[model samples]
Target: MKIKNITTFLLKVPLGDQRFYSSQCAFPERNSLLVRIETDTGICGWGESGQYGPGEPVATFIETVLKPRLIGKNPLDINVLWEDMFTGIRDFGRKTTGIEAMSGIDIALWDIAGKFYDKPVYELLGGAFRKKVLGYATGCYYRGEDVLDYKKSLQNLKDEASGYIDAGFTALKIKVGLLHVKEEMERIAAIREAVGNDIILMVDANHAYNFHTAKRIGKFLEEMNVHFFEEPVVPENIHGYKTLRETLNLAIAAGENEFTRFGYLELLKNECLDIIQPNIGCAGGFTEAKRIEALASAYHVQVIPHCWGSGIALAAALQYCATIAPSPHTAFECAPENSPMIEYDKNVNPLRDSLLTETFNVNDGFVQIPDGPGLGVEINMSVLKKHLTKT
Candidate 1:
C-alpha cells in the first residue's frame, strides 16, 4: 500500500508536584511529538520523536519537508526513504531536529511494514534474540524544592530508591552531579545502604562534570560497585570518554545524545565507551539503531538503548531491545551485567503511562516484548487529545 497522509500531535503534561531536576536542568513538564502515518489502504502506524526540545520544530519539519516526499512512496522501502530524508539534511541536520524528525517517520514506516506483513516490529527487524529483556528503573532525581536542603533531599532519594525496590525493580539508576561531590557521595552512600548490596545501581551525571571531577566521582562509584556511569562528561568530549573508560573500573555509557551509525562509529572507533545508550526516538529509529547495534557488536561494546519518552517510544525500544543478542555469545548463563537491559523511566509521565491502550509494566525486573503486529501497542487517542499542545 502507498502512504496517504501524515499527522502530528504535540503533547505536554505538567508535572506540578512531581517536578524534579537532573544535573543539567529541571523538568517541569514532559513533552512529546507523536507522528501518525496513514496508508491509502486504511492501515496506520504511530511513532514518537525525541522530546529533547520543543515539539513544534520537529512537527513542522515532518509536515512541510518530509511528509510531501513520502506521500506516494512504498512504506516498505525504509532504507531508501531514510536515505532520501537524511541526504536532504546531511550538512546541517545530522544531530538535532532534522534526524529527530526522520526518526519518527522511519519508525512509523517500520510499524506500517510490520502490520502489512502480519508480524511484530522485532520480527521485521530480524527475529527476537529474546522474548523479554531486563529493565532498570530510571529515577531518583533531585526534588525541585529540596535541592538546597541536603538532608531532605537525601531522605527523599532514599525513600524513592526503596520505593522502586518495593515496586519489584532490582536495578536502579539515580541522578548525580547536581550537588557537591561530597554531598553526592553521601546521597549515594545513603542509597546503597537503603537498597543493600544485591541491587544493581547506576548513576548519570548528565555531562555536568569535567575530566577531573568525573574521575573523582568514578573512583567513588568504583568503590561502591556501581554498574555504569552515564554521560559523565559531555557528548562532544570523545577523549574525555576514552580516558574515563580506561581509568574507571565501572562501565562508561554515553550515546543518547548521539545521532546515527556515523556518530556511533566515531565513539566505537575511539574505544570511548563500554556501553552506548542510543535513544530509538532520537537515533533515527530502528533502521539506524540496528546499524548502530551492529557497529557496537563489531567493536565488542554493549548496546543498552535509552528510553525517556512516551509509551510509543518505550514500545519501540522494547522491540529493538528484543532483537539485540548478547555482545559475545557464551555457553554460560547470561549474567545481569552481560544481559541486555532497557531504561524504564520511573519519573512522572502521564503520557508514558496513559497514552497507550496497553501500558507496559515491569514484572520482577523484566519486561515482556510485545508480540503483536507493529509496535504492538495502540495509541489512546482520547488521552492524546487530552494532552495535545496546539503548538
Candidate 2:
C-alpha cells in the first residue's frame, strides 16, 4: 500500500510539577510532536519525534516542509525516505527544527511499515530476541524548591527506592551531581542499604559538573558500588569523558542529547562511554538510532536508551529495546516507577496515562514487548483531542 497522507499533531500535555522531576531547565512545559501516517490500505501508524525542540513551531515545519515530500511516497522505503529527509535538510543545520521534523516523519514511516506488514515494529527490525525487557526506576530527583535537603532527601530516596523494589524493580536510578559530593555519597549509601546488594543502582548527573568534580564524584560512586554514572559532564566534552573514564572504574554513560549517527560515531570512536543512551525520539528517531546501536555494537558498548518523555516515547523506546538481541551491546532497560513497567510518568502528564487504549503494564520489574502492529499500542483519539494543543 502507498502512503496516502502524513499529519502532525503538536500536543501540549500538562505534566504538573512532578515530585521526582524539576521540569527540564530548557523546556519547563513538555510539548510533544506526534506523527500519524495513513496509507491507502486503510492502515494507520504512529510515531513520536522530539517534543521539546519546536515548542509548537514543529507543526509548521512538518506541514510545510515534510508533508510535501512525504505525501505520495512509499512508507516502507524507510532508509531512502530517511536519507531524502536528511540530505534535503543538511544545509539547514543538523540538530535544529529541520532534523526534529525529519525525526517525526521518519518514526511515522517505521510505524506505517510495521502496520503494513501486520507485525510489530520490533519484529520488522528483527524479531524479538526477548519477549520482555527488564526495567530500572529513574525518578530519584531532588524535591522541594531549595535543593533536595541532604538528609531528608536521602531518606526520601530510600523510601521511594524501597517502594520500587517492593513493586518488583530489580534496579533503580537516581539523579545526582546537583548535591555536594559528601552529601551525595551519604544518599547513595542510604539507597544501597535500603535496596540491599542484589538490586542494581545507577546515578545520573545530567552533565552538571566539570571533569574534575566528575572524577572526584566518580571515585566516590565507585566506592559505593554504583552501577554507572550518566552525563557527568556536558556531552560535547570528549576530553572530559576520556579523563573521567580513565580516572574512574565505574561505567560511564551519556548521549540522550546527541542527534544522529554522525553524532554517535564520535562517542564510539573515542571509547569514552561504557554505555550509550540514545533517546529514540531525539536521536534521529528509530532509523538513525538503529544505526547508532549498530555502531555501538561494533565498539562493544551497551545501549540503555534514554526515555524521559510521555507514553508514546516510552512505547517507541520499548519497541527499540525489544529488537536489540542479547548481544554485548545491551546492558538493561530503564523502567520508570510512576506507572506500570514503562517510563511511568509519576507526574500529571495527560498523554502519559490517559492517551493510550492500553498502557504498558510492568510486572515483576519487566515489561512485555508489544505484539500489536506498529508501535504496538493504539493511540486514544478521544484523549488526544482533549489534550491536543490548539495554538
Cα lDDT, all candidates: 0.90, 0.75
Cα lDDT over the full model 1: 0.90
Best by lDDT: 1
Stretches of candidate 1 above 4 Å error? 332-335
How does candidate 2 fare on TM-score? 0.90
What is the C-alpha lDDT profile of model 1 across 274-384, one tens digit per residue? Answer: 999999899998999999999999999998998888999999999998998887887642635666898889998899889999978678988889999999999998999
In order of listing, the candidates' clash counts read 0, 2
Model 2, runs deviating above 4 Å: 15-30, 52-54, 329-348
Residue by residue across 1-391, what tens digits does model 2's lDDT show? Answer: 7889887777775434543442234223566778888888888877777565554666677778777887788888999888888888787748757776777777777887787788888888877766777777776667654455777566777888798889888878887776677887787788889999888778888898888888888888888788789899998899899778878988898888888989888988998998788878777888888898888888877777888656778888888888664444235523321111234434345676778898777888887777888888888898888767752
TM-score of each: 0.98, 0.90
lDDT of 2 at 152: 55
